[model samples]
Target chain A: MSADRLIKLELSKLNVHLPERRPSLREALSSARPQVVARDGSTHAFKREELEFLAGLLPEADRDKLQLPILIALEPKLGRGTARISGEAEVKVVSQVLEKEASAGELLIYRPEVAILRKKLPTTTQYLFLW
Target chain B: MAALAVSPTRMELLKLRQRVGLAQRGHDLLKEKMDALVIEFFEVLRRIQEARMKALEQLSVAHRALSMCFAIVGTLETKQASKETRRELQVEISTRHIMGIAVPAVEVREVERNALVRGYGLHMTSSVLDEASREFERALKLLIELAELEGSAFALARELEKTKRRVNALEYILIPRLKEALKFIMMRLDEMERENFSRLKRIKAMLEERG
Candidate 1:
């Protein structure tokens, strides 16, 4: 029973670093100090240069559609070395970045592609683990 | 092949099964955490490589600038300028959580100050000295970032190795042993139930014969 309790505690802690609310691209670009509050109440700030780079990647109209700290869903069901980028704007941006045809509302990227995306958008991207 | 210290009962079997389930789930989650740590570690390593190259180059340039100062302003004057200059470089180090582990996140303030802010005295300041200071400041900034990256890589790797060990324990040891024990209990329970039925039948036959 104690082992069960410990496992539950470990499972609960997997996503504590996730932000309670993500800032939009426009908000991050405009603000001098743009940060998100994690579920555990820690602050994660976006680098200004990364923000500027993201702003350049999207058009003005699409700025609001794009969110800060893009969720990279890493699910075991997707098999190893694969992640899904959901949300319409997220799929669009990721597809363009990877030079792949854009899908509607979701896109799956391989490990190397994920590495490239993270390299290009370090502070702007955050990994989300899914069961 | 040590036996589990539990009676061969359905209740014990169920408990063992639940434990195996928990262990399996923990293993998968920890595995995912390990994979993510590897990615994060490699990313840090890539960044560190670039930062190291830039920092090392700038450092060599700074050294060259210092040598030039030594020749132009004389060795003692350059050494004196170095002494007068502010050398305390402070890095903003805060803890950032990577999964359950906390790694340091370091930020550096604007280290490359103008000659006036270098505060080596107005009269003693020279172009060569300022150049050396500026280059060294830039190098210091890059090195600070590099240090943070290296620290994170090591921390992540340590966490990754730890998680991997847990996963292997469950996958290769705990889960399999639990399953084997469960199988042994089930077999023993079945054998006992069969023996009980046979004993009951034998008693019934003797009683009927006596009657």
Candidate 2:
């Protein structure tokens, strides 16, 4: 029972770093200090440079559609070293950054590509773990 | 292997299954965290490599400029100018989370100051001194960046190690043990059911023989 309790605690702590509410790109760009508070009550600020870079990649109309701290979902079911980028705007921005083709609303990127993407946009992207 | 001590009952079996499930889930999720941390660690390292190179190069350049200043403007004068120059440079530091681990985010605002702001009087200050001051300022800025990157790399590496240990514990120890206990309980339950079946059959045969 204690082991079960420990596992439950571990599971709960896993996603505490994730933001409570992710701001849209439009909201973040318009604000002077673009930041989001995590579930753990810590503030994470987005670098204006990275935000501007992401802004340039999308059309003005799609700016609102894009979300800050874009989730690169890593699900075990998707296989190791593979991550999924969902949402039309997110997939588009990520694919454009990696110079890969985005099919449908979801994009599957490999480890190398994820590295490159994270490198290019460190503050604007976050890793999301999915069971 | 030594498994957990639990009664070989259906309820205990179900609880064991749940524990195994939780353990497996924890292992997989922690493994994912570990992998992400590795990616983060390498990224920080790659950034550190670039930052270190740039910082070192700037530092050498700054040193060369200082030596030139020392030669042209006289070492004693340059040292006096350095002492007179303002040294109160503030770096804004805050915490940022990368997957539950806090790493420092440092912001150096306006490290490069001009000749007038360098606060040394114009009478004694020469172009050489100003040049040296600017180069050193640049070097300081780069060094600050390098420090931030290095700090992030260390924090990420530590988190990665911790996560890796948890993943291994689950993979190599906890999950396996839970699974072993699971298997033991299922086998025992099956054996008990078989024994009960045989006992019932014998009772029926004996009753029929008496009748």
lDDT of 1 by residue, B65-86 (tens): 9899899989998888888877
| Model 2 local distance difference test score | 0.88
Taking the tens digit of each residue's C-alpha lDDT, what string does model 2 give over A3-85?
67877788888778789788899999999999999888988889999989988999999999998799999887788778999
TM-score of each: 0.85, 0.90
- Candidate 2 stretches with Cα past 4 Å from truth are B68-81, B120-127
Give per-residue CA lDDT, model 1, range A1-131, as digits (tens): 36567667777878888888887899888888988878887778788988887777778888898987898888877887789999887887888788988988989998888888887877788888877
lDDT by residue for model 2 over B1-211, one digit each (tens)?
6768978999999988888888988888788778788888998898899999999999999999999999999999999998898889999988778887888889889899989998987887688899999999999999998988888888988888887888888899889999889999999999999999999999999999999
Off by more than 4 A, model 1? A23-32, A48-68, B88-90, B200-211
In model 1, what is the error at residue A68, expressed in angstroms? Answer: 4.1
